[model samples]
Target: MLISHFLHGPVSAYPRDYVDGAHQELHQHREAQLLYAVCGTMRVVTAQGAWVIPPTRAVWIPPLVEHEIFMSGEVRMRSLFIAAELSPPSLQQCCVLAVTPLLRELILRAVQGPQHAENPLIQSLMLEEIAGLENLPLHIPMPEDRRLQGICLALLRTPDHPNTLEDWAQQVGASSRTLARLFQQQLKMNFNAWRQQLRLMEALPRLLAGESVQSVARDLGYGSARAFSAMFRRLLGENPREYLNALNKLSELNPLL
Candidate 1:
């Protein structure tokens, strides 16, 4: 359903909690949204792609974009609904944003006070912070072609499925060459790259839940932790342990985010 928020100002903040396995059905609002997971993890799915929001990260959703949120564990979500006019032109599409400490604090402050009548100073600071946020490479683009969509959906259900493009092509009734072409044209990546991204995205929540690196790697069908670590470092610029360490450091500094 399309929901319209009657905001008293340009920005309004909201806080909510969700338990493990909770799902927010597909919905959209008139205002652009900054969906932040202060704790736990959230997977935000939209028409174009899916983005994983862990602690210290948020998804910037442009107005009128249909989406759904899936919680991996207990989630404390802090949301900011900003009027469409206040949304930055450059951020017309949904993407994950790196939430800095200041931005996180601004969000908390906004939500702690009266939600309807937002403080002008905090609203100004929050918008400024949002405009300068760095976009993270946490999105996995979904394909539109029916053949590719079928294959992608099946793989998402089982990320560890060790199916080559040739294998998927046979299963989907398309030639391997044609499937490769569609992957490049639609997702801007080869099949292997896309699958790797999907695996990593799926791995994040489990890792945050205290699953060991070796366990996650084995569960994801990696031959060894070394192979998984190499892939993680190559794509995310850090090993799994290092990535978790950074997030832990942030938590130690401030438990709020």
Candidate 2:
């Protein structure tokens, strides 16, 4: 059944809390959901795609979209459900958002302190703040083909599995070229590119949890910190420290962050 009341009903606030490694069954809301992670990592997966939401960001799930959430480590989650009619046309689809400090505070209050978004002053600011948030490109698109699914699932389980496409092809009983073609057709990216993105997404939560660059590198199967930094810098245009420091900066405003 579709959950339609949160948006159409008078109850606009939805607050939820989850422990480490918590998993929620598939469900859809009538109203769009702003899923914020106050302390840990959240992985939101839908039929359309999969998103890795770190501390400094959140994901917007449009109304009536079946989805499930998996938490990494301990997680403090807060969400707001807006009326479907009130949701922006651009926000009708799910997206990952880079949460601003102001938006973060509004979400916190909406779920924790009081319903500040109910107040006229705060409501306007909250909507404006959300509109201004830049869309983050943090989603991993999955392929539906069983052959590709095996490869993707394996990498998803252990991102540092160190399996080349040739290696994966042998295990899956497909030619290396067929696997490569499947990667392109399903994921819209080659195997190596997809793996790089997977490693990056996996590394974010670990780094945000206070792991050192060297350790994260070792865990991700990089030869050294420099190698990891080069890849991160190349892909994200910033080193690991820059990304981790941004999270630290966000925590200054809201301690839960």
Among these predicted structures, which one has the highest TM-score? 1
- For residue 108, model 2's alpha carbon misses the true position, in angstroms, by 2.8
Tens-digit lDDT track for model 2 on 1-257? 46543532332555666888899879898777888877679999999678888876889898789999999977777777776666766776678898887878777776553445466566666677876778876778889888888888888898889889999889999999998888888878899888888888888888887789999999988999999999898876789998778776775566742
Pairs of colliding residues, candidate 1 = none
**lDDT of candidate 1?**
0.88
lDDT for model 2 comes to 0.79
Residue lDDT tens for model 1, 1-257: 89765456788888888899999999999999999987889999988989998777999999999999999888889899999999988898898898988988888777775742377888898899899999877889999999999989988999999989999889999999999999999999999999998989989998999999999999998999999999999877899999999887765655654
The lDDT leader among the candidates is 1
Off by over 4 Å in 2: 1-11, 112-115, 173-177
Error of 1 at 71 (Å): 1.0
